[model samples]
Target: MATFYGGVPLVTEPIKTPRYDFVRAPIDQVNTQIKNDLLYSVSNLPVVGQTAAEQRVNKDVARQLLAKVYLRTNEPALAEAQCDAIINSGKYSLVNARYGVKAGSPGDYFSDMFFKGNQRRSQGNKEAIWVLENENPSIIVNGSSGSPQQRRVWGGGYHNINGMIPADSLGGRGLSRIRLNNWVLYKLYPQGDMRNSKYSIHRQHYFNNTASKYNSIKGLPVPYGQDKQYTLSDGTTVNIAKSDTLAKINPYTLKWGQFDPNDVFGFGMWKDFILMRLGETYLLKAEAQVKQGNTSGAAASINVLRTRAQAPQVSASQMTLDFVLDERARELLAEENRREELVRTKTLLQRVAAHNTDGPSQRQIVGLTANNLLLPIPLNEIQLNSQAVLEQNPGY
Candidate 1:
């Protein structure tokens, strides 16, 4: 709440009676409240191995949240201490080798952790800090909260193509409601980066619909290019123009792909959502280090992930706030809430102006200003608090 809207009403206790006199607290007060609550949680919560349930929050989870709060509040040294506690705990580590349900399958270790059967710690994902388990609602009543659209939002809407079909290898059925920007697809990754591999990011689509005239090209790469044409086996010509490839054939991350043979329509995905993991702990530590002018320490912290990813090791000279954010994009794409990260780092305007201005006018991000740093408090919230004047954010 404090991160996005500065300081919101601190309702720490349950509302036993009607109250409308609540006013926004100072940002410092909010941070102190957050720290107290997290410290309480850290004291009460069990350690990682002590919890039998994988979904339950552990002490490390509280520490991670506290670390993030410290970072947002510009207490890098304190954040670094929290991060050190989690890292030195020896409870979590990065997924360096293939060890999951799909370990024998044709996929990388990074992508394997996102698979439905390979998410939890018992399922061989040692790096899973917090995983929300979801099951098929048809068999288990009230299994999921609601239909999860992660797959549809991140995966390509290739099934909309005439000669394509929903398949497990094709990331099931997706609507491509959100397409990755051109910078992510083209300029973000260097060659041989495992995170950008075909397994992690689905860059190619193949024809699988047997009923279509392009059946001859089944199990073959879809003929896609900017304004290119191809003649099918039945002499039917197909033209995939540049304008038609925004969502249909665009590249997307495979982290949210979950397919069920029983539920082909995929109204909901029955896969565990990894909320927090050790991979991000390293990034948080690096951010804190960079803030304290410990560039060498930050480089060492980031190289832990780089070595796991098999990407080139970075040096202390290359360590910057922008570089750390880029590494976040590369390491935690599709998993991290990017807007929150940018807002927390106060780089929304600069980063968006630099990398998110491509594509059509409607698709581009525009009119963002300093005022957008903190969102306007909702009108309903202000109207409901009639007993007090709830000030709004600046320039709202």
Candidate 2:
């Protein structure tokens, strides 16, 4: 890292679009300012006293941010070049084996990164680029704000289960507010792919409590034998026809599980959240290659990720922007913002209308169009400005 501001006075303003001010700058100008700031961070930050791992992580983050901005600006060559540099830098690598405290455990590389203590560079996952750390619940005297809800949003609210207690094996008490759409489970990952395996997604659940009458299956597995018959805690044998009976059909994810022995039902899941990792950089490169009409190069970029997950190799003929987006969904589902990714590719409305099962019935599918692509400028801004009128987006 080097300093570049010898004596120059750089002009700066807030990157966010003005809501209450009249005569706001154009969107492209704001984007240019953001791009310049990110470029400065990548090229001019000092790394004198930082540890080796810290320097590596900082560079990784800076490059990734630049690549993201490049993607937004439709600079495919620049985006692909940035991604290639990160992949070839030797500072980061895909986490292929169990490391850190969970070494020799029964977890795969994909699930290892999401575990409570395995997210940082010092924690042994070289895949991590930028991690948001949460202090341990026991030692922190003052409670934390902005604590992550990775578990609550991604994990199933199986607490809705009748006559069952929340357990670590069941991914704690998930609100399941942001459960996966059917496409993620049925369409994205191929069979036997590690990202969708039982290690990553919890497809089975067993009754764990013993007090209730439905607890006979307590210690018994769900959909066991498919006979749909279970003996009650009081010794009454009942024939349950539906396989999705309570205490049996809780299918969820274990990736965001952070068990706080102290507060089991606490809202905030105190675990380090991975902001960027090497796996997604590969996807970004593949996307840029596809945009540049180099399908073979895109396939090569994507194969690195597919090979690590033991997924079937993709051919150049199968390379498309949609394929790249699907791979992103499979590999970086809960780790990244799906909306932001889709919006970046300009496929948000189309994909939501196509793969979202609930979109049509809920009228969201019908409501989506090119006009609604960009958010409308706030109405208050227009009303407040007496000197000039603030234009709103087309739809709203």
Candidate 3:
């Protein structure tokens, strides 16, 4: 409701190196080179061919970065203008047409968020303006095995080990932590909501004898309440001995189908998480406009997205910063980019604590600072360089 500054929100801290500053003499110069390298990852965009695609990315990046800097620097109009450019560019739209439609059931919501098939190119993956080229889509989950191909496509990997199991290192090191916010669970409406149905659940009957059309059925688990473990064709044990977090599973992932009703983790947690989309951009632009005294403009922007989400339209009277903030939290949950969004909006700690009061406070927390704007910075640079002691991010 009230606006405040000097806060950073973080679900996880970035890795910090001891030495912290190697690779190049001028940081700006090094960053320019790094930017060039990032552009080369996409195949459709010419790494060496025409520069138009690069130009497109650059424009989008510049517009976003400008708002980020300006918002933090007190140049509201500049930030507003840049956001407008992104919104009106028409290159992207916040509305995800396919996912937003009413399937007349909660199942559709679950399918949209976690279903591997829903994320493919045909499903209006057009929302993803920038696609990270995954040579192989392999990912690791709380002490689970993964393969590159299946994780990326239809066969995602999941862990249905009892409940929320901790990752090996965290658990081995005795740092057990696997709990979901009850509020989040309640809001998820796991009952009839289709999205909730896709999560990890214990369906013993179908699980014990899953008939997969793909490789082998050995990896899937047997029905729950049984003590023994099953091994997959890959030789990984189906039931882990110790787990940190337990999943009701039914309301937690994109996995859905009529099974024996045993607990399982699905394909596993390997697929790439799409962090940015035109939808969030639309929301951000609208919020910026609201902050800059453009109530009408802000209303239009927010409604464009709400319309797509299938939620009711919001008028100018309801265009408070608090409303926008909560709307974003609900709309963009689990996107992995919300942390940065809260930070850029300059209200991370306050908003997070206000909503998730159980976490650590701002200063007491680690891995956030004014300078550490862009994450994904290489650790090697920190290890090789010495200035890192003063410049390395707060929580490494």
Candidate 4:
């Protein structure tokens, strides 16, 4: 049964006491870190009325997160109180940028404030509320590489003269491998999608991690309709003799259409990883609404998010927990770490078993108890102070 006061399930004795000093200390450390993070070391330090807006807002978020932890630990009143604190803050907002678009208008912001590159901007920024710092990869990653370099964009190999591979990529004359997953090349493209144009094909299908032939044949722009030597997607023919000499050879040995748009490390590098933006916050609120028995309210909230992705909104007639889970999976792909999320929701292990039936992660987690819900307290905490922690958790 749901613990109404805590808004969480029941917590047993072993989970409450926690066997290891390892367990108790980390919770204290996390709580301390969060309080510090929230207050800018001021709330607990007693420096009054000097708090920054960002620090204030961050503390509120930290409080909300703590509420989630509390709920997991079966502290419903604290969880609800924490949720209400942020909800009542009147500081944060749920905004839909596209709704304001007018005819011939330029006031539209295509951003999710919580996860986009605009979080640091001074004004009109939307979506993300708080985010941890991460660098945009560049010269910071690779040593001895020029100022433009980043780490491992396809293990680099190219020579400026005579078109040879570099010393790094098997003495880099050209790409050491001209390869693409056959599944990707053959199955992924569904027509009219740019991803097909973005992917590559293997050169000779000869070896692992290395291509057998050149791939630039497609990229060399020639007279329109002149690349008749190779099969075209549209089945058009061309006059090879009239085509530019540069157009005849594909630059890739076996890799086709796999060039990086950024041209980092001699190939395309994926630049951005947008995480925990407004979309997720919408989902979170929706989940909370459904949990509270307000189904229509949950559906209405979720629709706002769907409209942005240009995906169809969840119909009230079909709104269900399963649908929400699937929607979460679909929308959060590649952004949120599904592993941790599944565990927290107490749904991942079962879902994995249903899909793979016998996967290792599924089996391992099947035996996990409530204690596994939280992160482990590191071993170092046990050594420093005997009372700092009383015992290690079962898994540890």
Q: For each predicted model, how many residue pairs clash, with residues at least 3 apart or on different chains?
A: 0, 0, 48, 41
With candidate 4 superimposed using the best TM-score fit, by how many Å does residue 150's alpha carbon deviate from the native?
13
TM-score of each: 0.95, 0.84, 0.53, 0.47
TM-score of 4: 0.47
lDDT of 1: 0.88
State in Å the error of residue 318, model 4: 4.5
lDDT of 3 by residue, 1-396 (tens): 011112212112365744333232344343334334433432233321134542134445545555555555556676677677666765664434336322443444434533443443344455554433221222323432243322212211223332223222111111112233544545533243322333332122223233342135433433433345655565655454322123322122222221111212222333344545566676677777778888888899877766655566778887877677766655565453556667657677666455554423431335445444444334664455565332334444
- Model 3 worst lDDT window (10 residues): 168-177
lDDT of 4 by residue, 1-396 (tens): 111111211222356543333223234444445434544522342211123643233555455455545544444455545555555555555444533212133222332232223343233334444543333355345322222212222222323212233332121223323222223334333343221222111121111122223243333433322433543344543234422222222222211112232452443222223333445655665556555566786788677766654455565656655556655654453345565656656676566545443323422335645555555545675565355443545566
* Runs in model 3 lying further than 4 Å from the true structure: 1-58, 94-96, 99-123, 137-179, 187-250, 253-273, 357-396
In model 4, the Cα lDDT at residue 70 comes to 55
lDDT of 4: 0.40
Most accurate candidate by TM-score: 1
Which candidate would rank higher by TM-score, 3 or 4?
A: 3
Report the lDDT of model 4 for residue 243.
24
* Residue lDDT tens for model 2, 226-248: 55566676767655335332223
Clashing pairs in 1: none
